[model samples]
Target: MKRARLAWAIAGTLLFAALAVAAEEGKPKEKRKGPRLNPIAETMLRIDRIKAAVEGLDLNQEQQDKLAAIRDGFEAKRQAIQDKIGDLLTDEQRRIGQEKLEELKQGGALGREAYQKLEEALKLTDEQKQKMEPLGKELQELVGATLKQVMQVLTPEQREKVQQKLGMGKKGGKKGEKKKEQ
Candidate 1:
């Protein structure tokens, strides 16, 4: 039950993000004039958006149960990778990481500043970042797949509700932008 709850929270984060990336696949990429957003910062924003979108829905018991079941297979793998990454951190770094992670979990509005704050707090050694990179990447892929499965459990109407909350409609544009243009 605890695992399921955790999965649901994680699903709230990753699902819409995966769908959004999937939605943007064919568009010509736009280059920004300034420094680009870090992938971690972009992900954190997506997590907030997706989590809120899912929370706004009226999900049923069956949907909840299905999400829990889907999460069971992925949780252990995710945790193991997390543990392995934790093993690489120094004691002090781990302490700071825990504190920062908790603060982020509590929903403070850091924006892209969240990444900068973490980077400053950790002062992660090059060697540590090098070792954790692959594990981090693998964790991301696993979570993305888990999120996709969670979305599959939703009915089309429920899915649309989530997308709309994320400012994404059936055609993958901002929720009402197309209608406004037409």
Candidate 2:
């Protein structure tokens, strides 16, 4: 009788453990957090950073006025690019963009390569590329102009410090590393 009770107790404990494991398995997984910022938001954040960095340069009144104008132009160009992208997207395209953005957030080279392959396969028409190219160029020009104007306002020593702050030099920054790899 004693042996039988002991066996029953052991069996009950084992069954309880199994049920606990099963219960855990049946629960839904927690969802991952989405991207913190979209592309436009990221660009704006960079612009803000540039503005902050320029504030430390101690520009003269004329240079300050020019920098302000450059910043204004940059903002306007950024908005135009945003509007153009929005106008170009259809519902289906927006869905695809969301999926791509999620994939990017996941941080896998395979995902990026797959996206590149998809773009190559699609082979956008010449007309479409032509239409998009100017918007891209305009955005780049605005950003570059802003940077140039800011650099103009700074002394050589200050410029060097700013570049260091931006991680722009040859001490194994992202661009430098990429160039080395190539």
Candidate 3:
């Protein structure tokens, strides 16, 4: 009887151990972080915001084609700036920059804080910072011109829709701000 009891105990222990092992094996493996993005570019953030603002607008085929043409025309200039930025960053720096941008985007940092985040992420040597300064200026100009061209293509109603989506108004306050009493 003792032998029988001992055998059952051993069998139950083995079964429990086997079940535990099988449960672990059945779970999906945790994914390991992969290679970093090739280049981390903040230029995309502004471009993306503009696109998000207008993506759902009801534009005719003609308007769509016109906007597409403008974007295509600007592509070469944008790509040149991107290439220069890519040349300036090392792989590790790109990875760090990506992490920083993701953090800032998630945090919804804007204006001064956004600029500070980029400055922090760039983390370049003085010489590299100097080289980046002009590229940064050029990128800002390109983005501004692109935005202006894009806006001009939209009808007034469509422009208002885009502006509201972008959280701006004629008053230049964000979409939600308390008006000052006269």
Find the number of clashing residue pairs for candidate 1.
0
Ranked by TM-score from best down, the candidates are: 1, 3, 2
Per-candidate Cα lDDT values, in order, are 0.56, 0.47, 0.55
Worst 10 residues of 3 by lDDT: 15-24
Mark the 10 consecutive residues where model 2 has the least summed lDDT.
Answer: 15-24
Please give, for residues 52-169, the per-residue lDDT of candidate 1 as tens digits: 7776778899987886677567757755765675577678866775576566657662444545555556665666665655665565577567657767888888887766675554
Runs of candidate 1 exceeding 4 Å displacement: 1-37, 99-111, 167-182
TM-scores of all candidate predictions against the true structure: 0.62, 0.44, 0.54
Query: Which digits, one per residue and each the tens of the lDDT, describe model 3 over residues 1-182?
Result: 98976544433222221111222222344342331111112334455568788788998898899998887777668656556755666787667655665566578764334544554555566555545556655755776788778888889988877777765555433435524333
> What's the lDDT for residue 19 in model 2?
17
lDDT of 3: 0.55
Residue 4 lDDT (model 2): 73
Write candidate 2's Cα lDDT for 1-182 as tens digits: 97976544333222211111222222343342332322222333345456667777767788778877876676566656655644554566445544543454355422224334223333334454445545544554566667777777667877876666554554323343323111
Residue 159 displacement in candidate 1 (angstroms): 1.5
* Residue 151, model 1, lDDT: 72
